[model samples]
Target: MPIAALSDLAGKAECPLLVIKVGSALLVGKEGVRREWLTGLVAEIAEARARGQQVIVVSSGAIALGAATLGLDKGGRGSLADAQACAAVGQIALSGLWAELLGSHGFTAAQMLLTLEDLEDRRRYLNVTATLTRLLDAGAVPVINENDSVATQEIRFGDNDRLAARVAQAAQASAVLLLSDIDGLYDRHPKEPGARMIPVVEGVTAEVKAMASADSNSGMGSGGMISKLQAAEIAELAGICLVIGNGQHDRPVARVTGEGIGTLFLPCRKASARKAWLGGRLRLKGSLVVDAGAAAALERGSSLLAKGITEVEGVFERGDPVAIVDGAGQVLAHGLSEYDAAECAAITGMHSSEQAAVLGYAPRSAVVHRDQMVLK
Candidate 1:
């Protein structure tokens, strides 16, 4: 199977992790959780594991399933609260279904619900990563979904595609299989008469971007071709191959992997995924103003030092992500802070030796460690 072979090509030092993202449309049919389809997918996953692969599933449809149980209108939830309530109820069904099916196939299923902040915060990112590593080591499959019940932002609009990419990076996965309702990327919409499928993508260029449509093919899922393309971009940056295939077909995952029935995007990533994430995201909790020397050192792959820092500009806790800015207002790098805002303010201009005197306890010395930072 192409999906199974992809990891052998990457040759990860540890057992290769593979992520499968199932959208709401395929997961929740008119009756509720689509048991027949899910059972087949789990069977394929079990087969993959028998061949020494670790799989994680990122799924959507909590709200849809919950809405069905709650007797809400099929059109959409009336309010965000209603949607959240539905998710709180639906997540149980979703997780239980996965557990039941995977158990039947002799695999333990671990369920997790994550919010955006969980991955954005370095501290939380490490915790999640550690937990995933442990689970994989124990030979269990993880079933994950966005924490819709507590999502403050508008409910997940097929963000699971992107979330799948993030999970792949966090778990150091070699590939992601996004099982969708459509056949995969084409020259135009699949329904169009002359549309042609593109088999492999070395990179996501403008032409590739133009091929995607804003609307989803799956009437039930929020993500469309656009979301899948975005996911491909993230996977590319993280050096993880991502495939989009039609999951509605019988024994879908098996057919896609064995017959190579999907669009495969190759990866060309160079940095640690955590660092790539720090560089890619736009939201920074605060900025640390450093001198010219610090800026040059950062560019040459050095850590942020307290002695070079000139000022601390926003309130942030230790382990929160922040930007390292130069004197001229240019952002040099981004990284996780080792100290809180007040502590940073007090130690901004001090040397490593002097920090112990002011801080009462010895510190880690650098404001941000090189391993935790990514240069712009």
Candidate 2:
């Protein structure tokens, strides 16, 4: 189907929940918080909530506001610690603005800052989902942002675009609206005369990829068109439709929700909840190397058998997450290990049928069950 048609269908349907990601560029201008733009966005969100549709906002503006407030040079001359400190100062002001705007509409806004580690652990992921679900049920809008104040390079979400996609996957959102400075994804940078908007993208193909330009010259923020495309791919894999459009447009959320603007990316395939969690949520703690035949079997959707194991690296408990690597040292996939590191080492190269004898107790036939495996 054409993307416009799909967007029309989505807008007309009674979508239960919507995830909107507002970029920093739209939130902060040369002066300060773009009150006019923010006011419109809040109004739209309020309208949506009044219609009984839940909304979760993944917003980016802390660093920009921090830069402005501290009178520091934008996007330069700041160490990681400096930026973290700036975020710490700006977060308070940012939340205050949201609270005031939401308050006028007879609604309340709650702040939620997350790091990569929060979603990497299974228990934490479940807890986050439950909390957000409860907030939505209570008619409260959750304003989410990356925990930049304490986040290090190792545990950051990298960019708000990807973070928004992950949030949509965790919340099981119906669609993700990525509001940016640009109108939509185009054949090239929109500044060029010949650049044309590609309204519908069936998939992220090589041809579509070649059309992308690495022209993220924005000094105020890190994300650009490339990051937005990556977020679309992530959301598509998780069976959620994604739309990228200009946040500066009047009534941005309402316009997109009404099928009047932006580029729409259709979902390719729907992944199961367990598989999606296994694929995107878990952080790898160790790796298991396998031979070519074993890699082939895994690619064919088979489970990891002990006979195919070659070696293990790193220390991980039985329920810990591990990476499946090929003999050449390329990561094939990730899964929760069924045995401890020592047990897996002892049973390497043994037949799966003999697992019970080698370990003195068999847990399951496969080392990594098919249901627990996600192909990378």
Candidate 3:
């Protein structure tokens, strides 16, 4: 298929939520912030906003800028403490520049610092999603960066590429644009003779992954081509398209706006916000084995009832994710269990009316409500 048109895409139903990730190399240089590039980027942002699009930027360069300000080697020989110090100082520089530039374009730049926990925890995830939505509704562009000042190796996203994917997924963005030093994905390293750029990737299969195996160090940014591909995989599963393109060109955003300027990774399918959060992209805590009748009901768009469950496997509390399977061992749907395993065991095969009698209280009738399930 021909690459999707960016202008046409910007008019889609979900286009209001567009996430653009700017890499460190493009945003920073030996002198610190790249002024000319920022001006061009701001112009694009102005155009996008005028078109009624709500833009979110996942930006890198905090540590690099911080290191530069401290007279340290960029992205090299920095201890964790030094890195954290750099981030603490650099965030101010980054956000200040963004605020000033965006303000010049008659836009407000809202800064957000995030850690992996913000996206991993259920409560925090909902909060982040709500905040982003509210910011967009209020006509402010949110520029997010990882909270490197406090993040340790074990808790860090390690790269803004994956962080951007998570942000796009949670924000229910129509698409993600990754503007980097390189133009797009290639058959092999672009530095190698005869290597060809792959204009579009419909799926991230094993073959597609193999092409990204080479180390991705851009010298200034933490992510390489491998990280971009990994981020693409995350976006694909969340049903969000991802675009990777060169951000060094004049009118960087306009370049990607044209046809074939980048590699677009199309989503496998569109998934609803509720379904994506319920269990479509999560790890299940347990499973419910139901009879064929219940499986058929599920396929017919019915909720999972306690009376339909034959067995429960694994230990899980109420509100935890669980897999629903058929008697023949076919996975049907994934959802949050309304009751803990103990309560479920007591209420198994019981009618809805019997739930309160057996468990002393019934918060909900369905073991997994239709609204909380995503059919596999």
Candidate 4:
């Protein structure tokens, strides 16, 4: 299907949240920031916001700009220290330029830098999600990048493609767009005589990955077709469609709708918000074994109450994900706990009103609210 009319894809959600990834090649040049390319793209982003869509920009170019400033070769096997130095220097210019450009258009640019550890930790992940949600709610555009300056090789994502995917998943975004040097996936090397660009991919299968093996590096960028495909896989699992397109042309965001030079990877079905919340996204801290009455209430779409809890297994703080298990030891659901393991252990099987009296503090009514739980 020629989705040149992206509304078809976007219609999947009202007030759709979109993640846009700008590669280093598109953002950096020998002369420095590509003012023309970025200005035009920012214009599209501005229009998109005016049209009521929430947009997040995941950008690269810190290392490239830093290399230029420090007289280092990014393409070479530079030491991690040298790379970090470049990121430190370039990040200032990168974030400032984005803020300036978006500011000129009456939009605020919120800068966020993240490392693998931030997304991997359950608590930090939720914190990041909250910040992003608030930024979007306040009508600010979030420009995020990898925290290369403080990140070690072990903790780094290495490529922003995966970073963008993880961030989009965390935000529970509706779609992701990777704007790069190439238009989209090709049947073979793009320069081949008859190689054709596949317009739409329903799912990321072995054949799709084989096609991605032909790298689409633009010399200055780190991610290629392989990395984009890896990103598509993440989007697929998150029930988010991803679009790959060339940002070299005018009105590049137009390509996101399946128009212009772009390819759309659509997920088979949309995953529920509950699944995205507790479905392997948040790392579980522990499990709470509840009595039969509590288990029945949970299945009936009720919140987890402290009075029904029989056992608390695991050392988890409040707001951490914990599984709810039945008396038979069968897993029932996963939800965020309102109380710490110690507190829950102490207040187990007690009424909610008794908690404040016993613990000398007023706690939320539910141990694990129904809204937070993903029932099995």
Candidate 5:
């Protein structure tokens, strides 16, 4: 069957790494864990593995499982302590189920619990990325989740939708599947009389974002359409494709990929080696704002010169990832800064020939060399 959306990228060779996000409501309910659904999902994952596809799962439902098992009263808004307790208790059961299901298919399931801070901190981010890379290399499925048990508002993502996007970026996944309750994004609420599902989104525009609803049908899941769109934007920025589809169908994973029964958010474009490296950076040290002329030059694939820089924000060492914004505050690109922040400050607006007189050094003509930059 022809892919429903993103037909250009339907082939197996196009997607080497696939990250799938499973919503909580589909996995847990008042009746408890959904065994039949889990079984089908695991079979789909196994089939992908047999085809040499690398898969990672970012799953939800720990709190719902914990709440049900502990018999917690859920009649009103729950306290942080209650949520934390539920997550702690529920994570065990959730991980166990994944392990058992995958093990039955003769594949190992490794659990990875992470908080927002883990990804924000450069060191911690690299460490986690290394661990995930090792696990995937060993032919193990890394089942990841937000560390909800200890994640407070200060360090919490509030939902796994955005977290899954981050995981996809870190793992360098080509495609991500968001298995939600709904089949795809609609022009209006799906239940409304004249709602229409948008099959393909080449880009996330203001009009497209307006189509999403903030409310979710599942009380067990934290993310709604708004968060999923935010995740899609994130994935798009990182040059990764994302599909949002319903998890209720049989072989949902396979169908979404092969038949395209979902809304596919295409990336801006395929990333070159340098662009991919720059786009995947989780931590950026600073930013350099340039004039419109410089922005235009960069867009035309020209090198950035010191004379083009208008201002610098934040302290950054040489070789750190830095944002390159235009005069209107639009992010034009991201690249490695050739000079330190202090040097950049001293040399801003100076001609290339004048750099030696100002700093007694001119490492290169460009503040951010063309070879190191990725235009957004």
Candidate 6:
């Protein structure tokens, strides 16, 4: 689809719930937070809300804002701690700007900072979801950003693009609008000749993946087209449409919503909220090695059993997350463990009926219940 065609489709989408992810590059220009751009973006969001559309803003610019405020040179970070500190300072200023901007339009904005852990834990994920839903119900636009100041690399989403996708999934939003410096995904680097724009990506095929490059043109942001595609994949799985375009475009959201410009990636399938959270949110803690027959059954969407368990690695206690590994040691999926490390080790290769006899007490009916499992 061409940009014009996508814009037409976007306009025709019914009661679309929008998730707008504003990149740091557009938020902070060479000087600092471009007040004109920020004001314009907020006005667009306010307008969308007035039209009876629910809008969730996933914004990035904390570190950049902090750097500007602290007079630190861009890209002069000496350590992760330094970047974290910058994010801390920047987040405060970022929230203030959003509050003031939205307040001018007689709309209230609530700040939500989340780390990957919040999405990884089932309880925390539900809590965050409930909070956002209530805020939306109350007609307050929620401004979400990663808790970068306190997030470690292991628990970080690495970039806001991915974070936005997860947020879209969590909020069950209809579409995710990735507002960035670039217009859309191109056949090659847009700077290169003959690199045409790809208007609609139906799915992330191998061909589409090949076209992705990790080059970053935005000085204030970490992600590029590659990260955006990854985010799109997550959104697609969650049954959310995604639009990627230049945030610099005037009335960007309205334009994208009303026959503007961008690449639209349609949804492939819709995963239920519980399934989406289980499949895409939680991070695995350990692995459970199963026999070949067990692997085949699991591949066919069957639950894992103790009879199939040949070995268990890592010291995960009951309820801890663990990857279901095949006989060859390839990870097939992830699920919560029903038994502790010692219990699993003792019951390995035992029949289902023998579980209680060997362990003295049965942990659960299955080693990894299908309900808790998610294919990788």
What are the models' TM-scores? Answer: 0.74, 0.85, 0.75, 0.71, 0.78, 0.86
Write candidate 6's Cα lDDT for 288-316 as tens digits: 99989999899898989899999878887
For candidate 6, the TM-score is: 0.86
Strongest candidate by TM-score: 6
Q: Candidate 3: which stretches are off by over 4 Å?
A: 1-3, 6-14, 74-77, 278-376
Candidate 1 weakest lDDT stretch, 10 residues: 6-15
Ranking by lDDT: 5, 3, 6, 4, 1, 2
TM-score of 2: 0.85
Runs in model 1 deviating more than 4 A are 1-15, 154-158, 280-376
- Of the pair 3 and 5, which is ahead by lDDT? 5
Report the number of clashing residue pairs per model. Answer: 0, 0, 0, 4, 0, 0
Better of 2 and 4 by TM-score: 2
Steric clash pairs (candidate 2): none
Please give, for residues 257-363, the per-residue lDDT of candidate 2 as tens digits: 56556788887667787667666653587889998999999999999988899998889998888899998887787888988898889898888666778788764
Q: Candidate 3 — what's its lDDT?
A: 0.83
State which candidate has the highest lDDT: 5
Worst 10 residues of 4 by lDDT: 1-10
Total backbone clashes of model 2?
0
- Report lDDT per candidate: 0.81, 0.79, 0.83, 0.81, 0.84, 0.82
User: Between the candidate structures 1 and 4, which one is better when assessed by TM-score?
Assistant: 1
lDDT of 5 by residue, 297-333 (tens): 9999988898999999999999888999987787888
- Candidate 1, 151: how far from true, in Å? 0.5
TM-score of 1: 0.74
* lDDT of each residue in 1-376, candidate 1, tens digit only: 2333423422333336779999898888777778888888888888778777789999888988989899888523567787789889999999999999999988999998988778766678778899999999998899999998888653343368888987887887878889888878998887879999988887777789888987776566668888898888767767788988898887777667667778888755447766767764436789999998888888788888899999999999998889999888877777999999999999988888899999999979588999988765
